[model samples]
Target: MKILQDFELLFQQELHKLYDNDEIKAIFLVVIAEKLGLNTANYQLSKKDPVDDKNSAEILSILRDLKKHKPIQYILNKADFYGEVFQVNESVLIPRQETEELVDLIIKNHKFSQNLNIIDIGTGSGCIPITLSKHLTNARVTTIDISKEAIKTAQENANILKTAVQFINADIFEWEYIFSNQHYHIIVSNPPYITPGEKKYMNENVLAYEPELALFIEESTPLIFYDVISSFALKHLAPDGDLYFEINQYLGAEMKDLMIKKGFEQVKLIKDINGADRIIHAKKAW
Candidate 1:
């Protein structure tokens, strides 16, 4: 067994080869804080505290998994988004900061306290809809995903967060069949937009650990989900309803054009924190 300080140093040294020094330091802080159930300052103050043999072994084992490129969120089974923590696993893509920006944009643009009907098409971990439901207390939020496991995980997160969100397991490609008459005041999706060819540009941690079902599109059908979801929005969105998407950073213009062609007015592409084109907002004119 080793002291918390020594374990942290060991984790940092072992992970530095896989991540930048700063990232390694951040990971150490997060992991240590999680293990000790304290914040960074508190963890720092407790660094000299000795860890039991079992706990130390578990920490080292987690480090080994990190070295294997597994995501820290998967190892921890939780991810933070919009100031709330949600359970996550391999069944769902980890919630990301850029997606939080999308959710923030929606909240800022909409009357959250109104009884708006919102549906998220690819609800992973229920982050988007759960956060929206929590903040927009009067709004009716519903989310659907193709994967049953993903929906199960999302429902669990919603329950844990004590947010009421209707979760459905249905593929967006065939969404019309089941929800033909359903209309939403707001429709959102952060569907799979990364082309398979973009795999080379991704970190091994993501490519190996994250679900490809939620990550990739065929190179030839780069805009497949965008095209499909935009079409679905055209038919199902209420008059002047809004549609939002977390889009491929590389295809912002293409997404805008696609929305425009679908007769959505005021189509706009927004950049995320990194200044990468990441989100699309559009309104149904009819």
Candidate 2:
């Protein structure tokens, strides 16, 4: 069996073409640390130790999966969002850094507010609602997802994270009636906005490993979720309540117009680190 340091070199040699040198190194360290039951602090001291045969097999399997472009998060079955670690799997889309920005923006907007009611429409990994529940301490957070498997994964994350979020396993269209007489201080969604045609442009890691239902919108109705969720917010949002979305970068202008047409005020499109229009915010008139 190879020493841990040698496996690091192997990881770099095999993954260099697909990942940057820095990212590959980071992944290598994390995989070794997790696999060997060592934390970051002790990692350097253990690098020269020879890995046992069984552990070596697991490392080799991970390398093979990496070569196939499967995300490291899926391989590990865990993801970090905001400041919390969340369980993840093939059933749910991995929590993204861009979505963290969306959650942070909402927290900043309502940081001092209390007893708010917040409902998120897409409950992948329960990251959004769970993070909101943790930060906005007095808020009642509820989330919905169309996929039962996704809801199960999100619930598992919520339990693991020790956050209470009411989860609903229902399509937004079928479940609107359940909230007809209800109103919320905020409604948020990181819905499926990528059109079918855009799949070719997405990373193989995302397309091949992630759930398609959480990634693509129908080509004929590319903005289906945004349109429906924004319209739902029109009626279900409390007076002066806010609505937020993690949107397609290419569709920001269209999103702003749609929210305006839905009569939401103060519509704004915000850019992510890559300067892509990634989040949208709108407020209902008080």
Please report the TM-score between candidate 1 and the true structure: 0.96
Cα lDDT for residue 21, candidate 2: 95
Query: What are the runs in model 2 whose C-alpha is more than 4 Å off?
Result: 39-41
- The TM-scores of all predictions, comma-separated, are 0.96, 0.95
lDDT of 1 by residue, 186-268 (tens): 99999988988888888999998899999988999999998998888889898888899999899999988888888889888
Predicted candidate 2 versus true structure: per-residue lDDT over 1-286, tens digit per residue? 6888899899999999889999998898779777888776677888888899999999999999999999999999988899888899999999988998899999999999999999999998999999999999689999999999999998888888888899999988778778878899999999988898888888889989999999987888878898889888888898889899999999889888888887888988999988999999899865
Worst 10 residues of 1 by lDDT: 29-38
Best by lDDT: 2
Best by TM-score: 1
TM-score of candidate 2 versus the correct structure, residues matched by position: 0.95
Stretches > 4 Å off in candidate 1: none
